[model samples]
Target: MKIQTKINGHLREDEVEPRLLLVHYLRDVAGLTGTHIGCETSLCGACTVLLNGEAVKSCTLFAVQADGGEITTIEALGNHEKLHPLQEGFWEEHGLQCGFCTPGMILAAYQLLCRNPHPSREEIRKGLEGNLCRCTGYQHIVKAIEYAAQKIGSPDA
Candidate 1:
Protein backbone atom coordinates (compact mmCIF):
# COMPACT_ATOMS: atom_id res chain seq x y z
CA MET A 1 0.00 0.00 0.00
CA LYS A 2 1.11 3.48 -0.78
CA ILE A 3 0.45 5.89 2.08
CA GLN A 4 0.91 9.63 2.08
CA THR A 5 1.09 11.66 5.26
CA LYS A 6 2.57 14.80 6.70
CA ILE A 7 5.07 13.95 9.42
CA ASN A 8 6.80 16.60 11.46
CA GLY A 9 5.45 19.18 8.99
CA HIS A 10 6.84 17.34 5.95
CA LEU A 11 4.73 15.57 3.38
CA ARG A 12 5.97 12.09 2.58
CA GLU A 13 4.74 9.29 0.37
CA ASP A 14 5.97 5.75 0.68
CA GLU A 15 5.08 2.20 -0.21
CA VAL A 16 4.34 0.11 2.86
CA GLU A 17 2.68 -3.16 3.66
CA PRO A 18 -0.98 -2.80 4.53
CA ARG A 19 -0.29 -4.38 7.86
CA LEU A 20 2.70 -2.20 8.66
CA LEU A 21 2.23 -0.54 12.01
CA LEU A 22 2.41 3.24 12.14
CA VAL A 23 5.19 3.07 14.71
CA HIS A 24 7.32 1.01 12.32
CA TYR A 25 6.62 3.40 9.47
CA LEU A 26 7.68 6.36 11.59
CA ARG A 27 10.84 4.70 12.85
CA ASP A 28 11.92 2.84 9.71
CA VAL A 29 10.65 4.77 6.69
CA ALA A 30 10.65 8.25 8.20
CA GLY A 31 13.83 7.53 10.13
CA LEU A 32 12.35 9.08 13.24
CA THR A 33 13.74 6.91 16.00
CA GLY A 34 12.29 9.19 18.64
CA THR A 35 9.05 7.28 18.50
CA HIS A 36 10.01 4.06 20.22
CA ILE A 37 8.24 0.71 20.04
CA GLY A 38 7.50 -0.77 23.47
CA CYS A 39 4.73 -3.15 24.37
CA GLU A 40 3.38 -3.20 20.82
CA THR A 41 0.06 -4.13 22.40
CA SER A 42 -0.50 -0.44 23.29
CA LEU A 43 -0.27 -1.15 27.02
CA CYS A 44 2.72 1.17 27.00
CA GLY A 45 2.51 4.62 25.46
CA ALA A 46 6.09 4.70 24.19
CA CYS A 47 4.77 4.82 20.63
CA THR A 48 2.48 7.78 21.24
CA VAL A 49 2.45 10.51 18.61
CA LEU A 50 0.23 13.37 17.58
CA LEU A 51 -2.00 12.15 14.79
CA ASN A 52 -3.90 15.08 13.30
CA GLY A 53 -3.41 17.10 16.51
CA GLU A 54 -4.49 14.24 18.78
CA ALA A 55 -2.27 11.96 20.82
CA VAL A 56 -2.48 8.39 19.58
CA LYS A 57 -0.57 5.17 20.06
CA SER A 58 1.20 4.50 16.78
CA CYS A 59 1.50 0.84 17.64
CA THR A 60 -2.27 0.59 17.77
CA LEU A 61 -2.79 1.73 14.15
CA PHE A 62 -1.49 0.62 10.80
CA ALA A 63 0.32 3.01 8.51
CA VAL A 64 -2.57 2.84 6.03
CA GLN A 65 -4.97 3.96 8.73
CA ALA A 66 -3.14 7.26 8.97
CA ASP A 67 -2.99 7.93 5.23
CA GLY A 68 -3.51 11.60 4.44
CA GLY A 69 -3.17 12.50 8.11
CA GLU A 70 -0.67 14.75 9.80
CA ILE A 71 1.62 13.24 12.40
CA THR A 72 3.87 14.84 14.99
CA THR A 73 6.61 12.75 16.50
CA ILE A 74 8.94 13.79 19.31
CA GLU A 75 11.25 15.41 16.79
CA ALA A 76 8.64 18.08 16.06
CA LEU A 77 8.44 19.22 19.66
CA GLY A 78 11.78 20.99 19.59
CA ASN A 79 15.50 20.57 19.11
CA HIS A 80 18.59 20.53 21.28
CA GLU A 81 19.26 24.23 20.66
CA LYS A 82 15.78 25.31 21.79
CA LEU A 83 13.66 22.85 23.66
CA HIS A 84 9.90 22.82 23.94
CA PRO A 85 8.48 23.88 27.30
CA LEU A 86 7.52 20.28 28.03
CA GLN A 87 11.05 19.18 27.30
CA GLU A 88 12.41 21.93 29.49
CA GLY A 89 10.00 21.00 32.23
CA PHE A 90 11.02 17.38 32.04
CA TRP A 91 14.63 18.37 32.37
CA GLU A 92 14.11 20.79 35.24
CA GLU A 93 11.70 18.53 37.08
CA HIS A 94 13.56 15.32 36.47
CA GLY A 95 10.46 13.74 35.00
CA LEU A 96 12.42 10.85 33.60
CA GLN A 97 14.95 8.39 34.94
CA CYS A 98 15.35 5.72 32.26
CA GLY A 99 14.03 8.17 29.63
CA PHE A 100 12.28 5.45 27.68
CA CYS A 101 8.84 6.95 28.29
CA THR A 102 9.79 10.61 28.11
CA PRO A 103 8.70 11.18 24.53
CA GLY A 104 5.27 9.71 25.01
CA MET A 105 4.79 11.39 28.38
CA ILE A 106 5.70 14.77 26.94
CA LEU A 107 3.44 14.32 23.92
CA ALA A 108 0.53 13.25 26.10
CA ALA A 109 1.07 16.23 28.33
CA TYR A 110 1.19 18.43 25.22
CA GLN A 111 -2.23 17.18 24.21
CA LEU A 112 -3.59 17.72 27.69
CA LEU A 113 -2.36 21.28 27.78
CA CYS A 114 -3.81 21.93 24.35
CA ARG A 115 -7.20 20.84 25.61
CA ASN A 116 -6.92 22.42 29.05
CA PRO A 117 -4.18 24.88 29.64
CA HIS A 118 -4.86 25.00 33.37
CA PRO A 119 -5.30 21.38 34.18
CA SER A 120 -5.33 20.62 37.88
CA ARG A 121 -2.87 18.09 39.22
CA GLU A 122 -5.62 15.52 39.36
CA GLU A 123 -6.60 16.26 35.80
CA ILE A 124 -3.01 15.97 34.77
CA ARG A 125 -2.84 12.61 36.44
CA LYS A 126 -5.95 11.46 34.57
CA GLY A 127 -4.59 12.85 31.32
CA LEU A 128 -1.44 10.81 31.59
CA GLU A 129 -2.99 7.64 32.97
CA GLY A 130 -2.57 5.79 29.69
CA ASN A 131 1.18 6.26 29.67
CA LEU A 132 3.21 4.07 31.98
CA CYS A 133 6.64 4.99 33.29
CA ARG A 134 8.65 2.57 35.42
CA CYS A 135 10.79 5.41 36.66
CA THR A 136 10.16 8.70 38.47
CA GLY A 137 7.09 7.46 40.36
CA TYR A 138 4.93 9.94 38.34
CA GLN A 139 5.20 12.78 40.88
CA HIS A 140 7.92 14.44 38.89
CA ILE A 141 6.05 13.82 35.67
CA VAL A 142 3.02 15.64 37.05
CA LYS A 143 5.21 18.49 38.18
CA ALA A 144 6.80 18.62 34.75
CA ILE A 145 3.45 18.92 33.06
CA GLU A 146 2.43 21.59 35.50
CA TYR A 147 5.58 23.45 34.75
CA ALA A 148 4.89 23.21 31.03
CA ALA A 149 1.37 24.45 31.54
CA GLN A 150 2.75 27.51 33.22
CA LYS A 151 5.28 28.03 30.47
CA ILE A 152 2.75 27.59 27.70
CA GLY A 153 0.46 30.10 29.37
CA SER A 154 3.23 32.66 29.68
CA PRO A 155 3.86 35.14 26.89
CA ASP A 156 7.37 33.92 26.19
CA ALA A 157 6.33 30.33 25.42
Candidate 2:
Protein backbone atom coordinates (compact mmCIF):
# COMPACT_ATOMS: atom_id res chain seq x y z
CA MET A 1 0.00 0.00 0.00
CA LYS A 2 1.02 3.60 -0.51
CA ILE A 3 1.47 5.51 2.70
CA GLN A 4 1.88 9.26 2.90
CA THR A 5 3.37 10.94 5.91
CA LYS A 6 5.44 13.89 7.02
CA ILE A 7 8.80 12.77 8.36
CA ASN A 8 11.40 15.10 9.77
CA GLY A 9 9.62 18.06 8.23
CA HIS A 10 9.51 16.44 4.81
CA LEU A 11 6.41 15.19 3.16
CA ARG A 12 7.03 11.74 1.75
CA GLU A 13 4.97 9.12 -0.03
CA ASP A 14 6.04 5.55 -0.42
CA GLU A 15 4.81 2.07 -1.13
CA VAL A 16 5.30 -0.18 1.82
CA GLU A 17 4.11 -3.61 2.85
CA PRO A 18 1.50 -4.02 5.55
CA ARG A 19 4.03 -5.83 7.66
CA LEU A 20 6.78 -3.29 7.15
CA LEU A 21 7.70 -1.90 10.50
CA LEU A 22 8.02 1.89 10.78
CA VAL A 23 11.64 1.57 11.84
CA HIS A 24 12.67 -0.19 8.65
CA TYR A 25 10.71 2.20 6.55
CA LEU A 26 12.35 5.19 8.21
CA ARG A 27 15.81 3.69 7.97
CA ASP A 28 15.61 2.21 4.48
CA VAL A 29 13.11 4.36 2.65
CA ALA A 30 13.32 7.67 4.52
CA GLY A 31 17.10 7.42 5.01
CA LEU A 32 16.84 8.20 8.70
CA THR A 33 19.00 5.70 10.52
CA GLY A 34 19.31 7.57 13.79
CA THR A 35 16.45 5.51 15.16
CA HIS A 36 18.18 2.27 16.09
CA ILE A 37 16.75 -1.19 16.48
CA GLY A 38 17.62 -2.86 19.75
CA CYS A 39 14.87 -5.24 20.82
CA GLU A 40 12.13 -5.58 18.27
CA THR A 41 9.80 -6.73 21.02
CA SER A 42 9.20 -3.12 22.14
CA LEU A 43 11.01 -3.67 25.43
CA CYS A 44 13.68 -1.20 24.37
CA GLY A 45 12.97 2.27 23.11
CA ALA A 46 15.85 2.16 20.66
CA CYS A 47 13.46 2.75 17.82
CA THR A 48 11.44 5.47 19.49
CA VAL A 49 10.06 8.22 17.29
CA LEU A 50 7.55 10.97 17.67
CA LEU A 51 4.22 10.09 16.18
CA ASN A 52 2.12 13.25 16.18
CA GLY A 53 4.35 14.77 18.91
CA GLU A 54 4.24 11.67 21.15
CA ALA A 55 6.95 9.08 21.50
CA VAL A 56 6.15 5.60 20.18
CA LYS A 57 8.20 2.53 19.46
CA SER A 58 8.69 2.37 15.74
CA CYS A 59 9.15 -1.36 15.67
CA THR A 60 5.78 -1.73 17.31
CA LEU A 61 4.11 0.16 14.49
CA PHE A 62 3.68 -0.55 10.81
CA ALA A 63 4.44 2.07 8.21
CA VAL A 64 0.90 1.81 6.93
CA GLN A 65 -0.44 2.76 10.32
CA ALA A 66 1.53 6.00 10.17
CA ASP A 67 -0.07 7.16 6.98
CA GLY A 68 -0.85 10.88 7.08
CA GLY A 69 0.75 11.22 10.49
CA GLU A 70 3.65 13.46 11.44
CA ILE A 71 6.76 11.56 12.44
CA THR A 72 9.87 12.96 14.08
CA THR A 73 13.06 11.03 14.60
CA ILE A 74 16.36 12.06 16.11
CA GLU A 75 17.32 13.55 12.80
CA ALA A 76 14.35 15.82 13.07
CA LEU A 77 15.64 17.37 16.27
CA GLY A 78 18.84 18.90 15.03
CA ASN A 79 21.80 18.59 12.75
CA HIS A 80 25.59 18.75 12.91
CA GLU A 81 25.82 22.53 12.92
CA LYS A 82 22.97 23.11 15.35
CA LEU A 83 21.87 20.80 18.14
CA HIS A 84 18.59 20.76 19.94
CA PRO A 85 18.63 21.63 23.62
CA LEU A 86 18.12 17.97 24.50
CA GLN A 87 21.01 16.97 22.30
CA GLU A 88 23.19 19.64 23.81
CA GLY A 89 22.23 18.60 27.32
CA PHE A 90 23.06 14.99 26.57
CA TRP A 91 26.43 16.03 25.34
CA GLU A 92 27.11 18.40 28.17
CA GLU A 93 25.96 16.00 30.86
CA HIS A 94 27.59 12.95 29.23
CA GLY A 95 24.24 11.22 29.06
CA LEU A 96 25.28 8.62 26.51
CA GLN A 97 27.79 5.80 26.70
CA CYS A 98 27.40 3.32 23.86
CA GLY A 99 24.94 5.71 22.17
CA PHE A 100 22.51 2.91 21.34
CA CYS A 101 19.62 4.37 23.30
CA THR A 102 20.54 8.02 23.06
CA PRO A 103 18.25 8.82 20.18
CA GLY A 104 15.18 7.36 21.82
CA MET A 105 16.03 8.86 25.16
CA ILE A 106 16.35 12.30 23.65
CA LEU A 107 13.13 11.97 21.70
CA ALA A 108 11.22 10.74 24.72
CA ALA A 109 12.63 13.52 26.83
CA TYR A 110 11.81 16.00 24.13
CA GLN A 111 8.20 14.91 24.14
CA LEU A 112 7.97 15.11 27.91
CA LEU A 113 9.48 18.55 28.03
CA CYS A 114 7.22 19.70 25.26
CA ARG A 115 4.12 18.72 27.15
CA ASN A 116 5.06 19.46 30.74
CA PRO A 117 7.78 22.09 30.27
CA HIS A 118 8.85 21.51 33.86
CA PRO A 119 8.98 17.95 35.18
CA SER A 120 10.36 16.53 38.37
CA ARG A 121 13.10 13.93 38.31
CA GLU A 122 10.54 11.30 39.17
CA GLU A 123 8.27 12.57 36.46
CA ILE A 124 11.11 12.37 34.00
CA ARG A 125 11.79 8.85 35.15
CA LYS A 126 8.18 7.89 34.73
CA GLY A 127 7.99 9.52 31.32
CA LEU A 128 10.96 7.51 30.17
CA GLU A 129 9.99 4.21 31.71
CA GLY A 130 9.50 2.78 28.27
CA ASN A 131 12.98 3.75 27.15
CA LEU A 132 15.78 1.63 28.60
CA CYS A 133 19.39 2.77 28.58
CA ARG A 134 21.99 0.17 29.54
CA CYS A 135 25.10 2.29 29.38
CA THR A 136 24.80 5.12 31.91
CA GLY A 137 22.49 3.47 34.44
CA TYR A 138 20.16 6.44 33.83
CA GLN A 139 21.64 9.03 36.19
CA HIS A 140 23.31 11.04 33.48
CA ILE A 141 20.32 10.53 31.24
CA VAL A 142 18.02 11.99 33.83
CA LYS A 143 20.44 14.82 34.41
CA ALA A 144 20.58 15.47 30.72
CA ILE A 145 16.80 15.70 30.57
CA GLU A 146 16.84 17.96 33.60
CA TYR A 147 19.45 20.15 32.05
CA ALA A 148 17.49 20.44 28.88
CA ALA A 149 14.37 21.27 30.80
CA GLN A 150 16.14 24.04 32.65
CA LYS A 151 17.73 25.43 29.55
CA ILE A 152 14.42 25.40 27.73
CA GLY A 153 12.63 27.08 30.63
CA SER A 154 10.78 23.96 31.72
CA PRO A 155 9.37 23.92 35.23
CA ASP A 156 11.82 21.26 36.33
CA ALA A 157 14.25 23.88 37.53
Candidate 3:
Protein backbone atom coordinates (compact mmCIF):
# COMPACT_ATOMS: atom_id res chain seq x y z
CA MET A 1 0.00 0.00 0.00
CA LYS A 2 0.99 3.60 -0.55
CA ILE A 3 0.69 5.83 2.49
CA GLN A 4 0.89 9.59 2.52
CA THR A 5 1.45 11.47 5.74
CA LYS A 6 2.92 14.68 6.99
CA ILE A 7 5.88 13.75 9.12
CA ASN A 8 8.08 16.20 10.94
CA GLY A 9 6.54 19.03 8.93
CA HIS A 10 7.32 17.24 5.68
CA LEU A 11 4.94 15.49 3.35
CA ARG A 12 5.96 11.97 2.49
CA GLU A 13 4.61 9.10 0.43
CA ASP A 14 5.99 5.62 0.70
CA GLU A 15 4.99 2.16 -0.46
CA VAL A 16 4.82 -0.34 2.32
CA GLU A 17 3.62 -3.85 3.02
CA PRO A 18 0.62 -4.45 5.23
CA ARG A 19 2.89 -5.81 7.93
CA LEU A 20 5.18 -2.77 7.95
CA LEU A 21 5.20 -1.17 11.34
CA LEU A 22 5.10 2.61 11.54
CA VAL A 23 8.24 2.52 13.62
CA HIS A 24 10.12 0.67 10.95
CA TYR A 25 8.72 2.92 8.25
CA LEU A 26 9.82 5.99 10.12
CA ARG A 27 13.24 4.63 11.01
CA ASP A 28 14.13 2.81 7.84
CA VAL A 29 12.07 4.09 4.92
CA ALA A 30 11.64 7.68 6.01
CA GLY A 31 15.17 7.95 7.40
CA LEU A 32 14.02 9.20 10.77
CA THR A 33 15.58 7.02 13.45
CA GLY A 34 15.17 9.02 16.61
CA THR A 35 12.14 7.03 17.69
CA HIS A 36 13.57 3.90 19.28
CA ILE A 37 12.34 0.32 19.26
CA GLY A 38 12.41 -1.24 22.69
CA CYS A 39 9.49 -3.38 23.73
CA GLU A 40 7.60 -3.71 20.46
CA THR A 41 4.51 -4.74 22.36
CA SER A 42 3.55 -1.06 22.85
CA LEU A 43 4.02 -1.20 26.62
CA CYS A 44 7.38 0.55 26.52
CA GLY A 45 6.30 3.62 24.55
CA ALA A 46 9.84 3.77 23.24
CA CYS A 47 8.45 4.20 19.76
CA THR A 48 6.08 6.95 20.75
CA VAL A 49 5.24 9.62 18.18
CA LEU A 50 2.47 12.09 17.57
CA LEU A 51 -0.14 10.83 15.15
CA ASN A 52 -2.55 13.65 14.42
CA GLY A 53 -1.24 15.40 17.55
CA GLU A 54 -1.82 12.46 19.88
CA ALA A 55 0.82 10.13 21.28
CA VAL A 56 0.87 6.69 19.68
CA LYS A 57 3.36 3.86 19.74
CA SER A 58 4.65 3.50 16.20
CA CYS A 59 5.50 -0.12 16.70
CA THR A 60 1.95 -0.95 17.65
CA LEU A 61 0.41 0.45 14.47
CA PHE A 62 0.99 -0.41 10.85
CA ALA A 63 2.18 2.29 8.49
CA VAL A 64 -0.95 1.78 6.40
CA GLN A 65 -2.99 2.68 9.42
CA ALA A 66 -1.20 6.01 9.60
CA ASP A 67 -2.04 6.97 6.08
CA GLY A 68 -3.21 10.56 5.55
CA GLY A 69 -2.33 11.51 9.12
CA GLU A 70 0.03 14.10 10.43
CA ILE A 71 2.89 12.38 12.20
CA THR A 72 5.49 14.07 14.33
CA THR A 73 8.62 12.29 15.44
CA ILE A 74 11.33 13.39 17.84
CA GLU A 75 13.23 14.84 14.93
CA ALA A 76 10.40 17.30 14.34
CA LEU A 77 10.51 18.47 17.94
CA GLY A 78 13.64 20.60 17.41
CA ASN A 79 17.38 20.47 17.10
CA HIS A 80 20.74 21.49 18.61
CA GLU A 81 20.36 25.04 17.29
CA LYS A 82 16.88 25.50 18.72
CA LEU A 83 15.67 22.75 20.96
CA HIS A 84 12.06 22.59 22.02
CA PRO A 85 11.30 23.78 25.52
CA LEU A 86 10.59 20.22 26.64
CA GLN A 87 13.99 19.16 25.35
CA GLU A 88 15.68 22.04 27.14
CA GLY A 89 13.80 21.32 30.33
CA PHE A 90 14.78 17.66 30.15
CA TRP A 91 18.40 18.60 29.71
CA GLU A 92 18.42 21.19 32.47
CA GLU A 93 16.48 18.96 34.85
CA HIS A 94 18.38 15.79 33.98
CA GLY A 95 15.22 14.05 32.96
CA LEU A 96 17.04 11.15 31.27
CA GLN A 97 20.02 8.90 31.90
CA CYS A 98 20.60 6.30 29.16
CA GLY A 99 18.82 8.49 26.56
CA PHE A 100 16.96 5.55 25.03
CA CYS A 101 13.63 6.83 26.30
CA THR A 102 14.29 10.52 25.92
CA PRO A 103 12.54 10.94 22.59
CA GLY A 104 9.35 9.23 23.66
CA MET A 105 9.39 10.93 27.04
CA ILE A 106 9.77 14.32 25.47
CA LEU A 107 7.05 13.66 22.89
CA ALA A 108 4.69 12.35 25.53
CA ALA A 109 5.34 15.36 27.70
CA TYR A 110 4.85 17.67 24.77
CA GLN A 111 1.49 16.12 23.94
CA LEU A 112 0.42 16.39 27.56
CA LEU A 113 1.42 20.02 27.80
CA CYS A 114 -0.28 20.83 24.55
CA ARG A 115 -3.57 19.59 25.95
CA ASN A 116 -2.95 20.71 29.53
CA PRO A 117 -0.69 23.70 29.63
CA HIS A 118 -0.63 23.89 33.41
CA PRO A 119 -0.75 20.29 34.51
CA SER A 120 -0.12 19.46 38.13
CA ARG A 121 2.69 17.12 39.05
CA GLU A 122 0.32 14.23 39.50
CA GLU A 123 -1.38 14.95 36.21
CA ILE A 124 1.97 14.96 34.49
CA ARG A 125 2.69 11.56 35.93
CA LYS A 126 -0.65 10.28 34.71
CA GLY A 127 -0.06 11.65 31.25
CA LEU A 128 3.25 9.86 31.02
CA GLU A 129 1.96 6.49 32.20
CA GLY A 130 2.45 5.03 28.73
CA ASN A 131 6.16 5.78 28.75
CA LEU A 132 8.68 3.83 30.82
CA CYS A 133 12.01 5.31 31.71
CA ARG A 134 14.25 2.64 33.26
CA CYS A 135 17.03 4.95 34.27
CA THR A 136 16.08 7.80 36.62
CA GLY A 137 12.94 6.61 38.37
CA TYR A 138 11.00 9.51 36.76
CA GLN A 139 11.28 12.02 39.63
CA HIS A 140 13.30 14.38 37.50
CA ILE A 141 11.30 13.52 34.40
CA VAL A 142 8.15 14.57 36.18
CA LYS A 143 9.88 17.73 37.30
CA ALA A 144 10.98 18.45 33.78
CA ILE A 145 7.39 18.28 32.55
CA GLU A 146 6.33 20.47 35.45
CA TYR A 147 8.96 22.98 34.47
CA ALA A 148 7.78 22.97 30.86
CA ALA A 149 4.20 23.48 31.96
CA GLN A 150 5.09 26.40 34.17
CA LYS A 151 7.19 27.97 31.48
CA ILE A 152 4.47 27.55 28.93
CA GLY A 153 1.94 29.19 31.23
CA SER A 154 2.29 31.26 34.38
CA PRO A 155 -0.17 33.33 36.40
CA ASP A 156 2.67 35.64 37.29
CA ALA A 157 2.56 36.98 33.79
lDDT for model 3 comes to 0.91
For candidate 3, write residues 1-157 as lDDT tens digits: 9889899889998889999999999999999999999999989888999999999999999999999999999998878998778988898899999999999999999989988898888899999999999999999999888877776676652
Candidate 2 has its poorest 10 consecutive residues by lDDT at 148-157
lDDT of 2 by residue, 14-114 (tens): 99999999999999999899999999999999999999988999999999999999999998788889888899999999999999999999998988998
**In model 2, what is the error at residue 34, expressed in angstroms?**
0.4
User: How does candidate 1 score on lDDT?
Assistant: 0.95
lDDT (CA) per prediction: 0.95, 0.92, 0.91
Q: Record all residue pairs in model 3 with backbone atoms less than 3 Å apart, i.e. clashing.
A: none
Over 4 Å off, model 3: 154-157
Q: So what's the TM-score on candidate 2?
A: 0.95
**lDDT by residue for model 1 (95-155), tens:** 9999999999999999999999999999999999889999889999999999999998999
User: Better model by lDDT, 1 or 3?
Assistant: 1
State how far residue 91 of model 3 sits from its true place (Å). 0.5
Tell me each candidate's RMSD, in Å, in order: 0.7, 2.2, 1.7
